[model samples]
Target: MHFLIIGGGFVGTALACELLKQAPAGSSITLANSGGPLGKGLAYGTQSPLHLLNVPAARMSWTDEQPDDFVNWLAGQGNTCDGAAFVPRQRYGDYLAVRLREHIAARPDVHWQQLQNRIDSLTPEAGRWIAQCAHGPALTADRVLLALGNFAPACPHPSLQALPADRYVGDPWQPDALSGLPADAPVALIGTGLTMLDLLISLQAMGHHGPVLAISRRGLLPKPHRENELPPPQWQAPAGWLAAGSLRSQLREVRQAIGRAQANGQDWRDVWVALRPRTTALWHRLDERARAQFLRHLLPFWDVHRHRAAPQALAVLRAAQAQGRVQAAAGRLLGARVDADGLVALQWRARGGQDTQEFKAARVFNCTGPSTRLAEGRRGLFGHLLHDGRLRPCPLGLGLEVGAGYALADAEGREQPGLFYVGPMLRSQHWEATAVPELRAHAKAAARAALGC
Candidate 1:
C-alpha cells in the first residue's frame, strides 16, 4: 500500500523516516511539500545562526526511543559542541537534511518521492485518497497523513485587518517584508513573541535606526534561556494540582512549588521538564470552560514562561530596551484608520483605564503568531475538505476534528478511515502537538495505525 504524507517539515520527515525503518522493503512513500525535503518549511528554512531553539539539543531527538539521535548526527559531522547545548536552528535543519539524504541513499527498496508542489485538495476514490498537486498530476495513496505545520498569523484588530500591503507587513517570516523601509521610519511590531524578536534581529542586522513600538495586551516578553544551569533532573509537582484544581489556584501552587525547588538548590527548569510529560493530560482534564478561561486569562503568562528566548537573543532584546530603541507597552487597539500620509492610525488604551493614545506607524507588522482557525484562510486543503463534508473542524475551530488515534472525523463527528493528522493541526484536540517531543510520538502512533501494526 502506498503512503502519502502532506508537508515536509520535521514531523513529515520524521514520519517518513520512521515508516521506512519499520515498514517492509519496497514500500512506496511520497512526501508532498511545496518546499521539498527536509528543512523545507519556515521553522527549519531560516539561515540565521543567531536564531536558537527554545528547547535544548538533548531534548530534541527524532524519537524518545533514540535519545541521542540528533546529537550523535551532529557529532558525526565533526561538531565538538556539548551534547546538551542549544545549537543554532540552522544546524538543526542541516542535521535533518543530512539524515534524510542518508536514509534515501540507504533505502534502495523504498521509493520516496519528494514533490515540490503544494497540495490543493484531497479527494477520496476507491478506498484511496487522491491528492491534487498545484502543478503535477494527481497521485493516489492508500493512507494519507496531514503533517502541514504553521499557518499565517491572524490579525484581530481592525487597524490590522483593513491594512493594505503598502501600510502593513503581513508575514514576519519573510525577511523582505521589512525591506525598502526608510532608514528612520517609525515601525510598529504587533506582538512580542519569538517572531517579533526575529524581525528585530533582521532590522538590527540591516542597521535600521528607527524606534520600534511593540505592543501587546500584556506586553509580555519571552523568558531568556537558562544557559548556566546544568541538565536539570526531573522533579515532581504537587499531585493532582494541574488536573482537579482551578487554573489560578494551580498556577499559584506551581509558583510555590518552584520556590520550594529553588530552596533545595534545584532550578525551575526542573519543574518545567517534569511538567512536559503531564501537560497533555493536565490540558485534557480541563473542561471547555476551563480551557477557554486559560486561553483568555492565562495564555499570555503561560506562553512567556513556556517559550523562552535564547540567551543571546535575550541580550539583544535587553540592550535594545536599555537604549530605548524598543518600546514594549500593554494596550488594546481601539480603532485604526488611514491617514492622509497613507499610514495606519491606531488608537490604543493603556493599562489600568488610562487615557487613550494615538500613534501612527509607517509600517504595522502582525507577529501575532499562527492562525488556528483553518476556515478563516482563503487557501489550504483543509478548508476544501471542510466545505465538502470530508472533514469537520474541532469545536474550537483550531483544527480538523479527530479521535483518540488521530483519525479524522466526518461532518457528523464519526471517525473516518485512511485519513489522519499528525502535527500542530491537532492543536485543538491536543494542546501539546506543536513541538518536537509530542510530534515525534504522534507521528509514531499514526504510523502504527496506518500500517496496522
Candidate 2:
C-alpha cells in the first residue's frame, strides 16, 4: 500500500509519521508540499526567537499516545532548555525534521519521499488516486490526503488592491516581504492576532522603530495568559445550546459555558477543548441559517479566545503599548489611497459609532489571517476539486466541507474515494480543527481510517 500526503504542514507531517509507524514493511509514503521542508509550515518557518509557541511546551506534545516525546527529545543533549516553557518556533521545526529523519532511518523498508512541488490536481483512476504536481511527474498512490493548510486571507481593501509591488505587504509568511523597508518605517498591521505579534517582534529585531498600527473588526487585542494559578472561565453554555437552537440561544449558552468552566477551575480554553470532538457533529446539526448566524455573530469572540498568544509575547505586546509604539483600533476598512508623502492612507470606521478615522503609515501589512473563501484560494488543486464537483464548500464559506472521519464529501453528499482532509481546512465542519490538540487527534484518527482498519 502507498499513501500520498499533501500540504506538509503540521497535520500532514503528523499523518505521515503516524502512517509510516503503523504501516507494514514495503509500504510507501510520500509527502508532497510546495514548501521545501519536512516541517515548518508558514506558521513555524521563521527563525525569530521572539516568536514563541502559544501553548506551554509541556502541553504541546504532537501525540497524545506519547506525552513526553517532544520534551524528551529536547532533553537528550547537554544543551539546556526550560522544558515547560514556550520555546522558539524555529526550534520546534527543527525537532519535527529530526523526528521525521529518525523515523525514515529506522524503517529501511518504508519508501519515503518529499516532493517539493504543489499538487495541481487529483484524479481517480483504477481504484487509486493520481496527483499532478506543478513541476514534477504525476504520483500514483492508493490513498491521497489533502493536508493543504491555511492560505493567507485575501486583501480586503480596494486601495490595497491597487498598490504596486512595494506599497503593501500582502503576504506575511514571505521572508522578504518587509526586508526592503527602512529600519524606522512605520508599519500598519491588518489584524491583532499572533501573526501581528510575530511581525512586531521581527520589525523590532530589524531596528524598525516607527509607530505600528494594528486594525481589526473589534480593535480588541488577544488577552494575555493569566499568571499564577489560572482562574476559571465565567460562562457556562446552556443545554441544547449548540443544537437546534436559535442564534440568540446559542450565544447565551456559550456565555454560560465560559462561566461554568471558569467556576470549575478551568479557563475558557477548557470550553474550547471540550468542544473539539463534537464540533463537526454540531456543525452538521446546524442548518444553513444557524451556521450563517454563528459565523455572523459569534466568530469574532470565538477567535480571540481560541487563537491566543504566549504569555511572553503578551508581555512584549503590553510593553509596546505602554511605550506608545503600538496602537490597536477596531473598525472596517472604508477606503485607502497613496498620500503625497508616499504613505498608504487608510480610512475606517470604529466598531460601535459612525465616526470614521484615517491613518497613514510607511508600510501596511495584511495580517488578517488566512483566506477562507474556497473558490478564491486559487491553490489550483482545491479549486479544481471544487469546480469539478469533487468537493462542496460549507454553508459558512469556509473550506471544503468535510464529514466525519475527515472524509471529503461531494456535491451530492457522497464521500470521495481514497481521499481525505484534515486540519484547518475542516474548520467549516469542525470549528476547533486548527489548533494543535485537536489537529493531533484528527491526524491519528484519519491515519487509522486511511489504513482501512
Which prediction has the highest lDDT against the true structure?
Answer: 1
The per-residue C-alpha lDDT of model 1 at residue 235 equals 63
TM-score of 2: 0.91
Off by over 4 Å in 2: 78-83, 228-247, 254-284, 377-379
**Which lDDT tens digits does candidate 1 get at residues 1-453?**
799998888988888877877777878988888873465467877767777777778778878898888888878888866665878888888877777777777788888888878888988898889888889699899989888876788875755767777678778877578777887778888888888887788778778888888888888999876884345475676656566677778778788878999999877777877777778887777788888888888889878877877777878878999999888888787877778987678788876667998778888888888876766744668778877787776666566678777778888888778888887878777788878888999999988888878
Q: How accurate locally is residue 309 in candidate 2, as Cα lDDT from 0 to 100?
A: 74
The local distance difference test score of each candidate is 0.80, 0.79
Q: Candidates' TM-scores?
A: 0.94, 0.91
Q: Cα miss at 183, model 1 (Å)? A: 3.1
**Angstrom error at residue 109, model 1:** 1.0
Worst 10 residues of 1 by lDDT: 228-237
Which ranges of candidate 1 are over 4 A from the true structure? Answer: 238-243, 263-265
User: Candidate 2 residues 288-395, lDDT tens each?
Assistant: 788788788777776777667778888877888999999888888888788999888888888886988888877788988887677664648878888778988765
Cα lDDT for residue 332, candidate 2: 86
Best by TM-score: 1
